[model samples]
Target chain A: DTAVSQTPKYLVTQMGNDKSIKCEQNLGHDTMYWYKQDSKKFLKIMFSYNNKELIINETVPNRFSPKSPDKAHLNLHINSLELGDSAVYFCASSQWGGGAGMETQYFGPGTRLLVL
Target chain B: EDQVTQSPEALRLQEGESSSLNCSYTVSGLRGLFWYRQDPGKGPEFLFTLYSAGEEKEKERLKATLTKKESFLHITAPKPEDSATYLCAVCGTSGSRLTFGEGTQLTVNP
Candidate 1:
């Protein structure tokens, strides 16, 4: 079974439109995160939710928002999507935060979002 | 700012040959360093986690070693299937808000 899963593996949309991507983890991890990988393959963290609590929020556009219904799910919603938003968005989860950078993060298969 | 950089953007290797990939980082504190493998059109798969300087971890044909500011992933006797992009990430004291490198793509020709 897949540890982390994201829906709509391939999402093709248009600019100025709105879209949402969903992620779920079956690892029983307490923290779920959202990361965006650009054309350069630079993977950057967007948001992280710990036990359904927002823990980390990186420098992301205001058009992007993350919602965590519970510990097992984290969803990303984008408004007024721009062409620059075309990239692979990955969802990840970890069991606990070491607060000292000692934990391993598990990543999902990633959702390829294409804005045309 | 915290950053991770991997060298040799791409590598072409002959089967049964061995080599090492590098991952250098600039962060505030030394938390933990991670190693992952990514095939095309897929997410990264975890391989090893090194906690402190001089720590090492190994699995199958891959071995990971970490220092204060960098880490190295050594692939021994690599096979054709071992070809993939090796990604390194760092998560410091705050959380596993990992910062990933551009990744090193390895292509092993049998």
Candidate 2:
């Protein structure tokens, strides 16, 4: 079974439309994250949630929102999509470790979004 | 701000040829370092984790080594299927989030 999985591996929509990407992890991790890999192959963290609590929100546009229903699921919703939003979105999860603890992220096969 | 830089944005090596990719980071308190491989149109696959300096780990033809300020991913006698992007990430103990570098694109031609 896939440790982490995302739905709609490919999403194509017109500009100004809205979309949501769902992510789930079977690893029973307490932390989940959404990362964006742009056309340039630059991967950056968009948001992070720990035990369904918002923990890290990067300098992303307000149009991007993340909702974590539980420790094993985190979803990313986008509003008023733009052409620049065309990129690969990845979902990742890791077991929580305190100070001096080890953390390894397991990523899902990304969702490719294309805004026309 | 935590910063990570990867060198030689791209590398092309023939089958059986070996090379190393570099990942340098400047974080306040480095908790751990990670290496990942990403095939096109797919997500990143975790490869190795380096916790501190002088640490080394290997998997098949790949070896990961950590230093005080940077990490290295060395591929030995790579094959064509080894072509993919290698990513490096660093997490700071002082902070809970992970900061990632752009990634190094490697192409192993058969």
Candidate 3:
């Protein structure tokens, strides 16, 4: 079974369109995160939710929003997506309360988003 | 600013060749250093975690060693299948957020 999974592995839409990507984790982890990998393969953090509580929010654009319904799911919604928004999105989960050594983050397969 | 730098953006080697990738970091109060292997079109897969300086971890033909300033991932007698992008990330003591490097792309030819 996959520990972390994301819906709609590939998304292709026109510019100015709105879209959402869903992520779910079955590892019973307390923390979930969203990352965006740009064309240069630079992975950067966008948001993080711990036990349904917002913990870390990077300097992402206000157009991007992340919502966590519970500890097991985190969804990202983008408003008026732009051409520059094209990138691969990744979902990851980890046991926050566990010690640093024991709480290695596990990542999902990633969702490729293309805004033309 | 906290950052992680990886050397040799890309490397090509013959099968059975040995090499090492470097990851240097500048973070406050290091919690753990992580090594991950990623194939194209896939998320990174965790390989090892180094909690402190002088820590080492090994699996198969890969071995990871950590120092106060940097970390090294050594590949011994690598095969074609061992080729992939190796990423290094640092989990800070605060917030447990990971800062990732640009990653080193490795290719092994049979």
Candidate 4:
């Protein structure tokens, strides 16, 4: 079974279109995260949710909003996609404990988005 | 601000060649250091985690060692299948987020 999974492995749309990406984890983790990998292969954290509560929000654009319906699912909605928003989006999950930072995170296959 | 920098950016090795990748980080309070291997068109797979200085972990041909200022992923006798972009990340006590490096693209030629 896949520990983590994301739908729409590839996305291509106009610059002004709205889009969303879905993620789910069967690992029974308490925390989920979203990260973006740019063309240079630099991975950066975008958002984190713990038990459906927002925990970490990086300096991402306001157009990018993350929602956690339950501990197992986290969805990202973009209001107005831009060319700069085109990147590989990865979903991750970890079992949060005393120190959540020390936990090992498992990642999904990633969603490739390309905005023209 | 927490920052991570990976050296060499890219590396090339022949089959059976051994090498090490460096990841330097600066954070307020170090919580853990993690190593992940990512293949093209796939998500990163967890390899090891080093919680403190002098901590070391190993898996097959990969061995990760951590220090106060940096961490190293040493691959011994690497094979073509071992080729991938190795990412280094750190979790500082300041927050529940991880700061990742630019990643090192390792190519092992057979």
lDDT (10s digit) by residue, model 1, range B68-97 = 889999999999999999999887654546
Question: Where does candidate 2 stray beyond 4 Å?
Answer: A99-102
User: Model 4, A4-66: lDDT tens per residue?
Assistant: 999989999999999999999999999999999999999998998899999889899999999
| Candidate 4, superposed: residue stretches over 4 Å from native | none
By lDDT, highest first, what's the ranking?
A: 4, 3, 2, 1
| Better model by TM-score: candidate 2 vs candidate 4 | 4
For model 3, the stretches where C-alpha displacement exceeds 4 angstroms are: A98-102
Q: Model 3 chain A — which ten-residue stretch has the worst lDDT?
A: A96-105
- Model 1 agreement with the true structure over A1-116: per-residue lDDT tens digits: 99999998999999999999999999999988899999877888899888899888888989999999999999999999999999999998988653443556788999999999
Compared with the true structure, the alpha-carbon lDDT of candidate 3 equals: 0.92
Model 2 lDDT per residue over B1-110, tens place: 77899988999999999999999999888888989999988999999988889999999999999999999999999999999999998888666777789999999988
DockQ of 1: 0.69
Structural RMSD, model 1: 1.4
Interface RMSD over true interface Cα atoms for each candidate = 2.2, 2.3, 2.5, 1.3
In Å, candidate 3's interface RMSD is 2.5
lDDT (tens digit, per residue) of candidate 4 on B4-110: 99987999999999999999999999988989999999999999988999999999999999989999999999999999999999988887678899999999999
TM-score of each: 0.95, 0.94, 0.95, 0.97
Give lDDT tens digits, candidate 3, residues B80-104: 9998999999987664578899999
Query: Which window of ten consecutive residues has the lowest lDDT sum in model 1 chain B?
Result: B90-99
